[model samples]
Target: MAIIKHAARQTLGQLIGANNPVVTVPDDSQRQYAWTKKEVDTYWADIQKFRLARESGKESASEYFIGPIVTITDEHVKSRSLLDGQQRLTTSTILIAVIRDILWRIGSPEARSTASNIQRDYIARKAGRREPIEYFLVLSLFDRDFFRDFIQDWNELTGKVRGVEDPKKRPSHKLIQEAYSNFESKITAELSSYSDEDSRLDWLDSLYECLIKGLVFVEIQTPTSSDANEVFETINSRGKDLSTVDLVRNFLMERSREDLEKQRVNDAWRVLLDKFDKREEIERFLRHFWVARHGDVKSHSLYATIRGDLTREFDKRPHAYTAGAFAAELESASIRYVDLIHCSTGVDEFDSALSEIKALNADALHPLLLAASEKNDYAQLQDLIEACLSYYVRWTVIGRRESTLLEENIFEVAKEFSGGAGAESILRRVCGWIPDNETFKVDFEEASIPKPSQARYLLEKVEAKLRNTEGVDELEVASSTKVHVEQIYPQQPNPELRLDEHDSWVHRLGNVTLLNGRKNQTNSNRPFPEKVSIYEESALLVSSETQVFRLWDSQKSRWRPEGIIERQADLAKTALTVWPSSSQWQ
Candidate 1:
């Protein structure tokens, strides 16, 4: 049962004005300010509609409700720890700051006076001669100082303060600056429409009044922080638009009994947001981290699954499930996860293997890779990555197997590896899913690699294999900008060529070969003899290998469909050696 201290509807003025409890977003429990221009525009549009309705004296426009906020009310300190509604509250405060600045810019006596009063009553105040200033709404640590210096703190005589930290370095700080600028532009545009200073002042005052008194929120005050957290989770779980990251952070903070434990959670979360930097990236890392240990769970159900499992664990062995322990583990895994994503493991072979996997867009292997990275030595890790790459190529890229089964098997193997399975055991498990060489060859023979980049990857791998076998240095293939995937039969051939079936053969792996330079119109669609002359002049081993076209009888030698079939068949035989089965590794 939640211990609700009070629950009542309050206007924005009543919630943050003089004598109201000073509200603060707890650093450990809440996300930073995250409203972008899109949300700000909607807010501005709503305010305009509400102001119009109120001015018309419509009884239905008594107040505009902005939804609810959950907070932990501390009477002794006359402060509240806001548990939810940071976005709305922060955005509103930003609007107020914009209004104040615009009034000061107008420079009329009444305008300046209204701005001063707005500042003192709602924005911030100096409580006493010996006291520091008190802000009405204090943001979390990530944004607190920037918000104060850039948006909340202002002076009439000197102007807005300067020398704040660089917004470029902090993502949240950039958001605050953008929101303030967005509102400033909109308000300035509206003020410009007024012909005279007096009219502008009156317009500003009416807007201010509408904002202070019209915006309403249901303030749910709880007796304790824990109660506030519980209320927040309940409200969010009922289908509010809270993120899983926010929910998980709040839950962990609620479980943290000690200040140190809370700090650990806060630090870990800061590192997470800093390392990932984007919301989607952070969410992806969280899902991969969870799946690496706890098995597969969808994004929508991730929070519920984590909460239920952690609750059970805390109930069984509280000591082992401490916030600090989880924080340490999460932080460590995030570092490794970053390395995996960026292919910066510092081992050449491992990074090379990861680069290939990335080209394949095989993100499903992240869970298994994240697990293997933690326990396996560099050698073992390299082998595991190679095996995964091979498995993905054979099972997914070539075999085009059902994805659900592949994901399921990877998730199971990731769990096993995370639970101390050795490299060989994990490798074997992953390799077991790879299609047999004959199946892979059959698929590759008929594969239509429509994507130019994927076609280049396939050809480059074969080119390297051919180079290594002939006692020559393996040429760097697709990485070089000079290298291009040239179609032996051009996509848009000369009309007289009469190549009506060009579409069926253009993208086939056999018809495309890596060339040293860009394909031009004249050289690309030329008859086979001319193209053979171009190929012989190339530096790449793959281009030189194209000399096989010279072997055909001079009179009838043209690149034909049967020629592509015969070439792809030979390439398929070589592909088995390039991306071999699990048995090759053993």
Candidate 2:
């Protein structure tokens, strides 16, 4: 059973006012301020609606409940360690700061005085004349200094304070800056609607009052950290859920038996968020990390699965499953995970292979890549990457096999690799999943690549094979503005051409080739002989190859369906050399 010290509804002003305990986000329980533009817009809209309803004196007018906050209070220190609701509290403080800045800008005696009083009561205050000022709400280590210097300590006379860090470099600092600017724009617009200074000041005051008095929260106070953690989990589990990252962090913190263990977890989490700043990136990395060692699990059930599995492990071998151990492992793996995503392996051949895999958008193979990166040397790792790329090109891109089976097989291989399976063993398993050369050739002959980018990638690879150069450089191909994917049989061909079965042949691999400069559009719907002259002058080797099909017959030079079939057959034969099978690898 958990002990709850008190639970009651309180206004935002009552929660952060001079008479209440100072609110602080503890180091072990802090996540960076992560509310983006979408969240800020929603919050502002709600406040506006609530203010209008209250002003209208409607029966529906009621205090707006922002959400619940769980805290552990320490009377001796006169402070509360906020375990939940930091996002709401931090955002609310930012709104107040924006209002204060607007009031100061009004340049009236009453307005400035009201702003000063609001600052002292809700922003920050000094206990005694001689004591240093204490902030009303202190954020975590990552955002504490930036928040204080830029927001809490804004100069009343000068109207600005020097920022502690560059907002562009820090993701949380960027969010804070955006939120402040967003509120300032909206509030200033509202103030501009009133002509006289008095009306403007009144409007500002009303907005401030509406925020402090109208916004409500169910404040749940606990006697100890343990009690606070328990209540936090229970509340979040029932109503609107917290993020998976948040839940997982709190779970680890709650199970930590010592302060050092808790710090280790916090330190690891800080490293992770710093590496992958965006929420989606962090979540994806977590899921990939889990799938690499364990097996396939949906994103929604990841946290529950982690908790259940870890709990069972803890019961069996408590010492091995310590929080500190897991924290260290997670931190170490994040470094490799970053390398995998960014293709910064520092080897040209290896990075090229990784680029091709990325181009294919084969994220299902990340688990196996992450495992191979950990278990193999550079030589073995290179071979494994090539094997995975080949398998993906044949199975998914060409053969168009079902993805579920591929994901399952890759995940199983990743699990084995994580358990010390050799690179050769992993390669054999991946190669076994690939379609045979004959099957791949058949699929390639009939493949219709509708996506221009995918078509460009295939053509570029074949071009590289012809020119005897590395074709897997994603930057060279993806970033090149000079090269374009030209359709030989233009989708909107000129009506005079009288082409038959246009859709059937337009997107086929044979009809697509890379062209230089503006020739793609300039040669649009031109007869085969006219385009043949431009193809012969092309810079790419693949474009020049199209010259062979200029005259399907000597009597009259014209492109026909027979030409497309013959060209695709030749390209299919080349594909076998580009993406070989298991026997070729052996």
- Error of model 2, residue 478, in angstroms: 4.0
Q: What would the per-residue lDDT of candidate 1 be over residues 1-586, giving only the tens digit for each residue?
A: 8898888898999888778888889887778776778888999999999998899998999799989999888766478889988988988988998899888777778888888888889998787869988899998887888788887777756546543865535557777788989999998899888899988888888888888999999999898877888888888887644778888888888788899999999899878867765666677888999999989999889999988888788778888778677878889999988888888888888888877877777889999989888876555677678877888888777777788788889998898888988888888787787788888989999987888878888888888888888889767775798888888767766676545677888887777788887757677767667778777787787767744473234666445677777778888988999998888778
Off by over 4 Å in 2: 1-5, 74-78, 106-111, 167-170, 188-202, 238-241, 469-475, 481-508, 515-536, 547-567
Worst 10 residues of 1 by lDDT: 546-555
Instruction: Compute the lDDT for candidate 2.
Output: 0.80
Best by TM-score: 2
Clashes (N, CA, C under 3 Å) per candidate: 0, 0
In model 2, what is the error at residue 303, expressed in angstroms? Answer: 0.9
- Expressed as tens digits, the lDDT of each residue in 410-521 for candidate 2 is 9998989888888888888888888888899999999989888788889888887766644433334455788888887677766865567778888999888888775546
Q: Which stretches of candidate 1 lie over 4 Å from their true place?
A: 36-62, 74-77, 99-118, 128-130, 166-171, 181-210, 449-574
Highest lDDT against the true fold, candidate: 1
* lDDT over C-alpha atoms for residue 413 of model 1: 89
